[model samples]
Target: MDAKQYANLIDKELQEMPLYVFYYTQQPNLSVTTIYQYLTEYRRFFNWLRETPKDIENPNAGSISDAKSNKEIKLETLKHLQASQVQMFLKELSIKQNKQSTRDSKKTINRTINALRSLFHYLTVTADLNDGEPYFYRNVMLKIPLIKGVKESISYRNAKFSPMLYTGEKKRKWIDFIENEYEHTISTRRRSSFLFNKERDLAIISLLLGSGIRVSELTRLNLKDVNLRDRSIIVLRKGDKKDAPLIADWAMPYLENYLKIRKQRYQPDKSEQALFLTKYAGKAKRIATNTVECFVSKYSTAFPDGNRTTPHKLRHSLGTELYDKSKDVMVVATQLGHTGISATDQYIQQTEVEKQRIQLDKTK
Candidate 1:
């Protein structure tokens, strides 16, 4: 829905309805996306506002006629709304201790309330009115506290490292298919595509399977970033400026081949120094993130077991296998450029029930 039109409709509702309230849309500091979100949250509240009990004393509310939709009312006048009204809105947000009347998630409620609070705070701080009390409006807005968010779901530490994808033989099948067995389909479009991208495709898969770098990181590579002789490429890591290890032994040959093809195709800096280039005519551009996803998805037929796999899952397979071999969380974490060990622990942990199944003897 168009935010401007929704805001306009809400303003119309406020004007036609029996309420004396002002709704402002201007927030100079906010981004366009942020402004859209604030408007959407306010729109939700305003949709339910007409049905909500009016605690605020409004003289104009009595004069307005009732409409089927609250959107019919137009709001022009500005009026003071008390903290009690804000509290009433919060109380109606949830039905039970765990359930919400608005059916909004706690995270969503918290965001909406923050948006409301931020707007009011902005108004309160910037208000020019000084009727012997400079802090009056600001104090009213300060009273609007954040709606407490619900706790997150249980951690993977207690749960089994569930749904571990494309490991062992499954991992081999995918690798083999990409490295040797992959082929174009009978369709004209399928056969025509990726002719110039064969080496590029293999290199992408090799990087994921060998180095386990993120799709984003792969897309961000430069021509100078690779070193085939060293069999390592410097990868930008999370948080710190330190480089992550590039152990793409299998990927080096593919990278060299792709680079050779890239150099020949995009001779004399035609690739514009991007490590990966699109197969476009004339001047080629850098590969896109969505394009990388499409690149990985093109060979889903590689999974002979009919199980689905993704690049991240391949990354997970690398981290998981590393942990399985060495049982070192920090090693896996550092390899993956994870900021914390807690985030890395999920790759190693198995639930009690799942572990018990593995413990069962084969003779039984």
Candidate 2:
């Protein structure tokens, strides 16, 4: 087959492969997001495959920039791909530049490899990988190990490289900003259901900024998940059933107020099992992940420069604050629902006062 036909065939197959593996395979509880990300990785690989220098009878291969004689990509080529090619692909992700000389970040490169690993595992075991013909990529992909502890420095986006983790004055300023500026602005705004939304937004923002709740965890919460009496929430972190994360006492008032308004706003019969609902629709429906992101985008203006005010940022802010107050790794771990200390360690940051003292002692 010529390059153009092969390219068209490959694109069509790659698109169908993930769904076939996801649904037809016997795996359970894999979230939609994981499948989406894996599909993205497949697209990235195939895009580069078009430019690979092998003499595949593909006509469009020349259309890809800098096509060379050393590489080739095709459905038939996948099974033949040895470990060396896989390693080269993974390495190229971090170092390879586009026409603009831009490269993927260390974090993204790592994730892309993970996605490849998953897809290749599927290709190895499945019949035709949902693309009408059987592909035996298992030998190649399953053998490809994760890249780790490499001596080379990882590339990252320098433009927005500052830690999103809030600390000290930045942390305190945000707390006050949300409490005073955000809460007050919403409370006083001349809009319908201002009180209802303010109460709800405060509860959400406070929960994220106070309890270190992941935005996914926050969205997944149900009425049964919350314990108003003990101010605790039973959150399913990373899809595992775990002990409930406790809510801050101060955030309770907002939760109490929001629940009261939510009940009044939505009819009991039509309301879904979602803890957070949208009022924009006549029928109160669950707030989607996109809604949660848009909500953060809407209120991000309240934060000062250097403080990126996304939901994850708020969680980091709260985690750092909790660590500062408790000085306990377990405390941070339990609240954030992290299974390990290494994961929780990233959340804990030195307060400005502590940093200042350390610097003073350094001179002394």
Candidate 3:
């Protein structure tokens, strides 16, 4: 089939297939965005196949060709992908001479590999009996092994050896550090608008720190999700599941105050049911995730020690704090919407043993 026809067929198949069935049969908790991304990636692979030389005997292999010739190629094209080709791709990615950090490179490689794997897997399941199914086609691409140097750096970068939980004396110091720098400034039109919406910003920060919510989840929150009387918010956690829980005591007052100020600042349009809105935009629009990150970074800059501050840092801080307080692995996992306890345990295991030893010396 031609490229356009091929795409139309794929789209038709996707539309006919129930999304819920895909979730249940394949990735049960997959988000709609994730599924859509996989579909796009798979489409790109087929497009690439349509252009590339199909036969091993063809010396001019790897070159793009006309679509009409693609159908003449044998179905063995799907089964004959070499492990060496994948390795070459990885090598090219690693040495591409970009300014991206090691973490960014890792992310790019991981995403590309996942896209490739999804295409191959889809072919294995969907292709007809006449298609030549090779042995290697069944083996999913192995996860890239972390080099020792990369692994060690990532371990340290994630604060796998932090000295203290973010609570008690540490929490007090951090809070004092933040509050002291909280100058109520209205320097520019933008600043004035942000200042006018300060209460909402504060509430958002508090909730982030308290709940360990992802930025996307924070932006998607609506008024109906919050229960002021119960001091809880109904959040759509990962996998698009509704889960309600109590707001941390520290965050509740801030939210209440923000709601009061929000009522006075702008009239909510009929379509605007979101709890948080952009300060400069009309109340009909919700605040963007990047706006929330920018605000956090702005405040974080006020404190010299807050160099690593971002929306995600608040999540890490909460997880670290919870682990320190309760020492309950499952509790922390549930709070952070983790599917399992291994994620929470990593925080616990990463606690600096040397720091604990030093604290023991203080008692003497």
Candidate 4:
């Protein structure tokens, strides 16, 4: 087959492949969404190769004159791809011009690695064998090692703000005040909308603190996902096909109140199924994730002493609270919809203050 046809064929096979096959075959526990994403990335790579000139020395020679030509490029491009080239591509990505933050850069690296690994694995297993032997696809795999870097010099005077010395009671008090007093307070400037808006904010914060759901998951919530009678929400956990339990008994009352106001304000049009809505133009009809984030940020700023909180910080607080209260790794894992106990362990692991408290107890 020609290059374009081969690319199309691969895309088709990827799209048609059963996710359960991966579990029974080599890579068990690999999510279908992950596989799809890898395939998409590989397709883009092929498209780039097809468009790029084979010989950069002579740009005008041996190049497809018509931009509209949809014919497949040479198959040699795929065969010629080497480990060095792939490594160079990764390096280029690391230094690529973009607005990505440190966290986003890490995520991009991870995604790129996954995509490259998936492609190479597919080629090794499914494609023709090289040298009549199994070609292990290890070259594309990330070779990350935890290397210790130079430690920063610290003076005794500079070493301050130790977690063991810092009492979190004051911080907790501030958080409590924000939740209890500042969160629900409303102004009379807009009488008709005041109660509705306040109820919405309360429900939003309550869900964040109570269920510890990610902002993305919270935004995707629909009326069907909610179980008012059971006081549970069906949250779409990462890598899961179906929504799982994100129950919060405390959040039910506020949710109910919000729902009542929501129903009254925006009587369900055919397109409106989301739990939240906004009054802004273009978004007047549909609720979005950013809207919820902005709402959370606005109220978070009301706290005295400039305590900067985000929707995600509320999730962290919930996890911290659960860890402190139960001290059970499995319980926290289940509550947070985490696939394993290790994630929960990270949340509950004793801080310096907790360690100091233990030491004080031993002295006592």
Candidate 5:
């Protein structure tokens, strides 16, 4: 979703303080998606506090009022939050079931911690309240630590996804399988829709593998962002950085094919600036992130030696391939629009782990 969509969602959720609005909108660095996520995390923590009121105390030795709604929980509640209560919230998050009914991962828990930390940091240091003073002098979040085992989680993900990634020969064959072979594999009922969307799907998957752009970047892409002559496309990268990443020569043909027939096939309104469009309920709208994920999964599951995968794995395929060829972490980082080499460093570690795994398999 775009900024407006995310803002609308934020409006529907609890906006307990003007500080919440300022935190999300006034900050130039936070992406719309990040704002939405942080708001939800704030709500989660607030709800947890309401349910576990014993965790809360009035700083002035006064009784804490029962918060009938999330909005009813005033700023003073956050000011007096203790370290132990925050720790308990993190523990609950670890075992919390999402809409998928699966327990939250450590990453999710850490993100929640990070979100709360941002909020507290702003209240204590950033916000200018009455008399030019911040909300509170004590930041409880400073005492909380993020969950560890990040490297282990990265290794686990690398091991599981490395084999499924499309790189080298697999990259070319995956696209080939989609064009010539995919239709034959699906049922007659599904084939019609598949054929109708073949070009757009191919372009989407090809772009993902060809350039290491995030799924969010691709979904939020606009028609004017593509510079075909320069062999690059401009994107609003994470942290809202405007970047133009080069696309692979191999993926150009698929993109070109899609461009030639996009308007005719999708019949999008002239005012529609979205680079990719899907026809739904007789209206052409920008292709959504979930829609891209679904088709990517469908195609990968049908491909021989392919597992059900996400657009991110396709990004990994590109990143790993770039690192292998250039043997330079900086180049991969630039292409992937990573602010630091740490994330790109995982590509190197993942490849090393993959190699070690193969050697072990050979020994076995």
Candidate 6:
């Protein structure tokens, strides 16, 4: 979804949460996606507080499930929570298995901790009560530590991702497969839908691999954002910062092919300005980020050894490919609009890591 859609969802969440949460989520420069994530974490933590048994010593704290809603729970129950209880909640999260039946990763747990920390910080240091004082000086999240091995996790992630990249000749081959061969693999009933979206799908994946824009950035593009003569597209980066990234010459034909038919194929309304269009109820709408992810996953999984990768993986492919050509981290960082070279550094490391993995396999 776009930022506007997420903002609408955030407004609904605020209705169920405390007034303090509204202030917290409204702070300037916090992306709508970030605000939505914080609200999700808050809901999960609140549900845990409500379902857990009442404490023996805290007899008056029977407000657990009796409270009508999260707002009441936040006001009456949150203020009385002990640091031990917060720690126990983290412990439960550590062992909890998701719908996929896999334990939460340290990174996932750390995100929860960060969200809770933001809430507590807002309550303690930011929000002012009716009496012109902070909620309660005690912030339980301060006592909860984020999981360690974050640096190790980064390297581990790069190693796992290195083999999945569509670098070198593989990038062209992947795009060709989608354009020419992908229809044969699906059922006849599904082929019509597949053919209907063929050019649009190929264009989306090509742009991602060619320019390294985030999926969110891709979904936000309007018709005017594309500069055919310049071979660049303007994108809103993280924090709503705008930058124009050059598109690879090889990917331009797919983009042209899609644009030539976009109006006729989608029958977009005159007011519709989205660069990519999706038809809904016979009306054209800007494509959603989730829809982009779903199609990227589907197409990539069909390609040989594609491993069901994400758009972000395609982003890494572009980063590494640029690094290989320019042999400059600074160029990759600028192309990817990374604020620092730190993240761009990983694209350089991926080659060495892949070599070491190959050596280990040779030894085996």
Query: Pick by lDDT: which candidate is best?
Result: 6
What is the Cα-based TM-score of model 3?
A: 0.71
lDDT of 6 by residue, 1-364 (tens): 8766897999888888877788787788788889999898998888787777667478576734566677766554666677788877788888888778988788888999999888888788887764888787778778788788546565787767776788887887888788888898999999998898889989999999999999999999999999999999999998879999999999999999999999999998899899998887888899999889999889888898556778989999999889877879999999999999998877887756666788899986
Model 1 bad stretches (over 4 Å): 1-164, 184-186, 238-242, 266-271, 350-356, 360-364
| CA error at residue 4 for candidate 2, angstroms | 36
TM-score of 6: 0.89
Residue 116 accuracy (lDDT) in model 4:
60
User: On residues 25-68, what C-alpha lDDT tens digit does candidate 3 reach at each position?
Assistant: 25445554555556554444445556545444684765433344
- Candidate order (TM-score): 6, 5, 3, 2, 4, 1
Evaluated with TM-score, which candidate comes out highest?
6
* Local distance difference test scores for all models: 0.60, 0.64, 0.61, 0.57, 0.82, 0.85
Number of the candidate with higher lDDT, 2 or 4:
2
Count of backbone collisions in candidate 2? 11
Checking candidate 3 for backbone clashes, the offending pairs are: none
The number of clashing residue pairs in model 5 is 0
Quote the lDDT for 115 in model 4. 68
Tens-digit per-residue lDDT, 1-364, candidate 5: 6455777887776356344445435667777677788888877677676677562454444323358767677777778877887887788777778788988898888898899888888788877754687777889999998888546567777777787788988888888999999899889999999999999999999999999898999998998999899889999886668999999998998899999999999899999989998898999988888889988998888899677889988899898889988879999999999888998876887667757878899986
Model 3 misplaced stretches (Cα beyond 4 Å):
1-29, 32-79, 98-104, 126-149, 153-186, 279-283, 350-355, 359-364
Candidate 6 residue pairs that clash:
none
User: Cα RMSDs of all predictions?
Assistant: 9.0, 8.1, 7.2, 9.0, 3.5, 3.1
- Candidate 2 residues lying further than 4 Å off, grouped into runs, are 1-15, 18-20, 23-26, 44-53, 56-77, 82-103, 123-138, 142-196, 266-271, 304-306, 347-356, 359-364
TM-score of each: 0.59, 0.70, 0.71, 0.62, 0.88, 0.89
The order of the candidates by lDDT, greatest first, is 6, 5, 2, 3, 1, 4
lDDT of 5 at 141: 90
